[model samples]
Target chain A: MVVNASQDDPEKARRFREAALPYLDDAYTLARYLLRDAADAEDAVQECYLRAYKHFDSYRGPAMKPWLFAILRNVCRAEYARRKTAPTAVEELPEGGDQTPMWNEAPETPEKQMLRRFDGDTVRRLVAALAEPFRETFVLREIQNLSYREIADVAAVPVGTVMSRLARARAMLRSAWLAEQEQAK
Target chain B: MTCEEAEVLIHALIDGELDAGHAREVEVHIEGCAHCAVLMKEYQEIRQAIAESDLRYKAPLELRRKIEKALPQPQPQAAPSRRSVLRGFAMGSAVSAMAATGLVAIVLRNDDEQRIENEVVSAHLRSLQAGHLIDVVSTDQHTVKPWFNGKLDVSPPVIDLTAQGFTLIGGRLDYVNAREIGAVVYKRRQHVINLFVAQTANTERKTAKVSTLQGFNIRRWSDRGLNYWAVSDLGADELSEFGDKFESAMRANKEG
Candidate 1:
């Protein structure tokens, strides 16, 4: 509830609105994918904006997208932990051995055809199913189209980590997607 | 470039994050290597599918309005800023402007009441925490009553009602609707009751309405240019009975 004196500047608030409001949809989209809940995404976006306004003076980052996204990521972290303990999200698939997907399956014609035939809902589901770091990287690079360096700014990781996460995320998505297509056939 | 190096750079290349040198190298690798080429094509398709999909969840209009309302407004200063002056000029014709917008005088009473109830209930719960319930702890209304003088815009009525089963506990300042209001505390058996009083424009009296919220009973009424809400875990009947006795004492003091 403590209001910083700088946050109360009308001129500053005006400048913030001009600079930040245009990305509400983008922020909302990132939040929705991150949280997987509509109401939580809305709240996260609102908190992100409020915090951004509070720290508008301190923001000298690369661009507005990464800056707001970094704030949104911080906000979603707590929600993610809370969600992990919640009964709804407790059943996580175990990871090891067979859990690591076999990727050497020959690219049958059907898998390639399915790759070419992009269904919106199916793509969204596969992306949403990805675990963190990967999910976040994919959404930033593919959906929001942020550069890897920009994503690293938001994710607080090295550019190399962003590169690896993006590559791994794409591989995971491709395999999961191709597998799903194989199943449907 | 080797296929291993090209694999790391393919996504960057597709996303146009790579410089021309790296992009051309990755393209050259993909040209001869069918495996890397297929992987590149699949990654491209995935990115394209996501891009073409209608997955961006636009914030609801209500959320925008809610956030706008919640943000702190710039406090008007001694010498009004130009924006404030313009705002004042706009407000000068607010009635006409509001009428034009067809929202001249529609305050949703239910929403306001619902919001206030939540705030007061939250304040009551917070006060229950250790060292938070009272600013001035006293069993005498005389001491509790004077503690609020000059602190608030209006002096809340603090009546000693021990003889009527509710014992004077203490009082404190609590916040509601973004303003500090007086809270007169009392104890009924083991239950604590907070009587929140705030200044209101309504001079007319409204009968006490008892409502249950979060397992706590609240009896709210507006009278004599002040609004009152008595919140407690006591049963509804006992709480309203306490309200009646307190009102009678207030009336008796006024008449005498």
Candidate 2:
């Protein structure tokens, strides 16, 4: 008898696969955004699944998305530290940036046409451009559609921090979208 | 609600995170306020654009298949040995460390030893990352020793030197030379000394070889059909001393 038996138990493994495998795409998306390298992202996702499986029996959460994502975040974070990469590059909103309606002064393009401009690649690029904690918050909200409470649990930050981060993330995203639109003109 | 009061709530409102009373309050504020209305629309459009863009990366089919196949089971296929079973223990952490900053694309070319050293140093760097310094966390050498019994081909020598300057922190499996090996972790002050041991087919009198790579020093030696590599950012003299202390402790245990 070993300290860990679920590893050798087919039933537990099956349950874990059912609970955790459905979110593989979600996990990959987060990892791809965090690492920005396909190979590295795949490696991180693999590590996340392995780590999650090892501790699957201990998991008692209602949802598997956040729990699995939390594991993935740590894996990518370790990669960041291992590479000794620079800290997340946070872009500050300019003075009165959000005070004025950010999209107000743009040349009068139809809202429909303007939004259609945000193609998949462009949207992904802008989202990826967001800094850490903020980028992570934005992805969890807009992409994964996790509730703020779930996000707070996954990120291990206070609910207030998540709210403020979402606010900042939205502001940053809007401003970045406007800037990109302006450049296109 | 004042514009200032409703400003922060708009995000929650857009996400439908707000309660009925608060959501109504934000709705009231936006109805009366044009600026707030525009802001709300902008946020909604951003969310919509992202959704329409379909940015979620579906895990590739190969990746899905790979993960499904690798899930540990009572009788799993493709995992040939304990080494593969313990491979996850070794790759427990994603890698980033100060030493890894200087890692450029270096061609190992014809030197197999050089390639192995690079990988060993890389594993050391990865283990330094937080939340994964050790998989089996214990200062007790007794507990740490047996953890690798079924996980690895050979049990690595886990020496407890809490009485000495170095403290036996814990142990984890680390990938080195393309095999899952045991890494006995110790800490001297703040520095981590990772002792990686692997089984050698042909035992030879390989004396202690000290080498420095990527801002870390590795002191390696072999004994009784096993190879050992102790890597740390600790000074060469100090790490070598740790290696010496460990070797004697292992010898004394074997003899006595």
Candidate 3:
């Protein structure tokens, strides 16, 4: 089916798409951060969209981004719970098996140069390495530019908790970033 | 307020979560207190750096497609009618042929649905031993059902068996690849069973077929092309009994 289905009501559908489109990428990215797998993240985002569509009738807000994100957050949590139970074959690596060190420190070559962006990639890896809750709060507040109330609504937590967690999450991310900077020297 | 409290509020002030009155109070406090102001600037810089770093992820395309297919379709109409909701979770219909054969007892060339039962039972036991009880969690059936959207094509009927002594722990997205299957997960006195289902046009299916594999007991049955497989490490007799109850509930729901 063409997902961009505005056949019956072009104007209504277009408005929906216009409002929904910008958030889709951010929603999926947040899902990926929460889920750590490409497939599950996609599932979470799609679920968020469907939920948003079904409830679109009830939406009485100036904007739909926060409402949409709240749904995405739930989908991500549910997906995380499911994956936690499912059987997976995890390859064993060193105790702190973060790839940043190995890949960054590896001998430079033309092929590796094509794949380069040592610092940015390192930062990305550190972000992923943070604990799920911390990383999620950090991403939502700092990167996604969501308000504390919005994050609270999305995370299903109190605003006070969101504020505290955001503070701690930033502290953790900053530490991780600093550590990476040190390691790069 | 002391510097400690003011310092924490500095971050909050930057985020604009602080009320106007509190913001004014914090501003006055920070103006009089240089230390808090400096801390506020540091928090702002940290936030700005994070925002400007391009650290935010760009989801890959495959991830987007997979999620789009997996997410739940809106079903405002499906709400009050419980049976229709469960029927929407037609497990057999969603699965690929291979996983369809794995979770249900259908089109088996062999005479033994018993063997299949046993194998499933063993797998169930492994699930328990491994502490893999459920993939999704929500008391609401709607929440649990959408969990399998992309992972399985047929919606496995999620029946809350809590009143029947089997608590509906949740639902999970299961796979047979290129065909998603739904596994309506339930629990009974610490025992977990995955009720794998799919839609099919075939009826006149067996009521009960029991087997044991890997120290687990299983029962397989089908009513109206919807195949049901119940597997547990619980014993053959007990599993058979539970299967009877489950099948009857399903039948009553269907007929009524």
* Maximum-TM-score candidate: 1
Q: How much is the lDDT of residue B205 in candidate 3?
A: 63
| Candidate 2 ranges with C-alpha deviation above 4 Å | A1-8, A85-116, B73-256
Tens digits of per-residue lDDT, candidate 1, B141-170, equal 889888999777676889999999999889
Q: What is the lDDT of residue B46 in candidate 1?
A: 72
- Determine which window of 10 residues in candidate 2 chain B has minimal summed lDDT: B90-99
Q: State the lDDT of candidate 3 residue by residue for B1-256, as single tens digits.
A: 7765674566688887898999999999978976556555655765666655666555444553554354332221112232332443454454344245433323544633454454345335434532344667766677887776656445676766666677777875433211234667777787777776754434346667776666666677776656677766667776777777777787788889
DockQ of each: 0.28, 0.29, 0.16
What's the lDDT of the predicted structure labeled candidate 1? Answer: 0.76
Off by over 4 Å in 1: A1-8, A87-116, B74-256
Q: Which structure is stronger by lDDT: 2 or 3?
A: 2
**lDDT tens readout by residue for model 1, A46-129:** 999999989999978669988999999999987877888888873444432222332433343323343646566777888898
Task: Please give, for residues B1-256, the per-residue lDDT of candidate 2 as tens digits.
Answer: 8765676789999888899999998998889987777777877888877877768775554576567667655323322343432432243231122115331211223465565677788778767644557889999999999998877777787889887689998998865643568999999999999988976532344689899999899898876556788899999999989988888887888789
Model 3 chain B weakest 10-residue run by lDDT: B73-82
When sorted by TM-score, best at the front, the candidate numbers are 1, 2, 3
For model 3, residues A33-82, the per-residue Cα lDDT tens digits are 77777777766777787777666667787457778888788777677556
